[model samples]
Target: MATFIALVSALLVSSVYSAKALSSNYYDHTCPQAESMVSRTVKKAMLSDKTVPAALLRMHFHDCFIRVTPFCLAFLLGCDASVLLNSTSKNQAEKDGPPNISLHAFYVIDIAKEEIEASCPGVVSCADILAFAARDAVSLSGGPTWDVPKGRLDGRISKANDTLQLPFPTFNISQLQQSFAQRGLSLDDLVALSEFAASLQSVCPMHNKVKNAGANMDTTPVAFDNGYFELLLQGKSLFSSDQALLTNPKTKALVSKYACSQEEFEKAFVKAMIRMSSITGGEEIRRHCRVVR
Candidate 1:
């Protein structure tokens, strides 16, 4: 029995190392230039080797939906303060924008570090951490995993492109679909991705005022579930982008499929995300893959 337990532990450790090696290679070969504040933050969190990127994402999710920075800071420790520097109000200023950072960007690193810390300690590579976090973040927020080419190496330069390419709140489906397909995702993935609407916030009353933005998409927006779809059925979309999910037949059918029954959305969403989360990252090195480190 002890031998079996030892073997199991060994296998788990080996898996972590393998993930790190593949992800690091991905960064080197693909995203060789992945140097940016976001990258650095990912590195620092992985460096902590304690928190999980998924867990961090969970916290970012909780705080954003709850509209409490303290909740964010609680899990992140002083990192939130450091990220904000001296200006606590900076978060508020940035709050009105799309909920990308808090929902996806911020939490990916947290979970990656949590995973790495369980195995290699400081030896777990930051690039690997970021890659894992990125893929998981997409899954966490209702996006597809697709095929992420690995072997990305860290470059010396950094820029805004990687951060900018993220979807905006108001972007139309035609454009958003192209963005996902470019990343190798499909329409099914796109439809399930609306589950991210669970991360919606009602900040400042007018923040989510699509047709009726101030309203919560669900009874529990903080929880990753199908509440957002039901909101679409009510014509109470907070973002123009969300309303389109119902009005646009190409995608609306999927939304209705979920809205008609959260059970349907929950099953499809979880399965699709599992498929997406299982993707390996930093595998492909294209001109656009890495930020200008």
Candidate 2:
């Protein structure tokens, strides 16, 4: 386990030191209001549906993770907003994939895109919009805020099969590490981002036929905090992947640290999110987030 962590740390350092293609102020001149427009849309949506934050945050994670190519062992156009594409008569999109079937709150992105389009025309990309929306979702839910680096392009290809590449809730420690490492993410990144996994669990336990019945990610489900980690330590997490964190001493230590300090959790989460969302792919910026230009 120590050797594996060392290897991942080395890879993470190399990836971090590489030249960055995205920038926090990429839209300063072209669309100064891009971030605010997304934030406003998220805030408005949350007012009516408290689940909006978790949905958007999960959407961004799905978007980024599905872009990992197995053979290449690297992220290919990850976080390109391909997940926002809609299924057409000829083909299904990532949004309609088996794994993403439960993904909701896409309307929030559509509304934000429409508003940004009205104000800045075609200057902003849907990928950047989703990124900003995810950031806003966290901040508004009592999580920390960080400036999202923009300049991501929306991928035209969004295959339903691609989402199958995503990590599953049943993944063990080894499987989870390989999944994250394939996308250039380290164990630290995995531990920091695992908080979002709480939202991925089924609203109801398996085999329960209760309609419209569900479960909260934590006691304060609507708020983004270290509560997930705290709950995980208590063995309250619903997913096998969540419980897998405890199987490893290093990751278990991280879970404990985060549970003890919300400040540290927020700091690590922001850095992990920035790094994860920075994996870019796509060729063109679509006028509509659901369709290619």
* Cα lDDT of model 1 by residue, 1-293, tens digit: 53343345334433432443333243444334332333445434433322223434333222212211121222111101111111132222222233434422344444444444444333333333344444444343333433333332322222222224345668787665654443334556767755653432422122322232323422312234566777777887777777756656768888878767766766676554433332222222122211211
| Number of clashes recorded per candidate | 37, 1
Candidate 2's error at 223, in angstroms?
A: 3.4
Q: Give the per-residue lDDT of model 2 (tens digit) for 1-293.
A: 74575466447534642444898789889989888888888877766666677788889999988866634534477888999999999989999999899888899999999999998998899999999998987777667889888898888889999898899999998888878776777778999998755632333222332322223323333455688888899998878998999999989999999999988987888889998898777878889999999
CA RMSD for every model? 16.3, 4.6
**The CA-based lDDT of model 2 is what?**
0.80
Q: Of the candidates shown, which would achieve the greatest lDDT relative to the real structure? A: 2
- All candidates: TM-score: 0.45, 0.86
lDDT of 1 at 152: 29
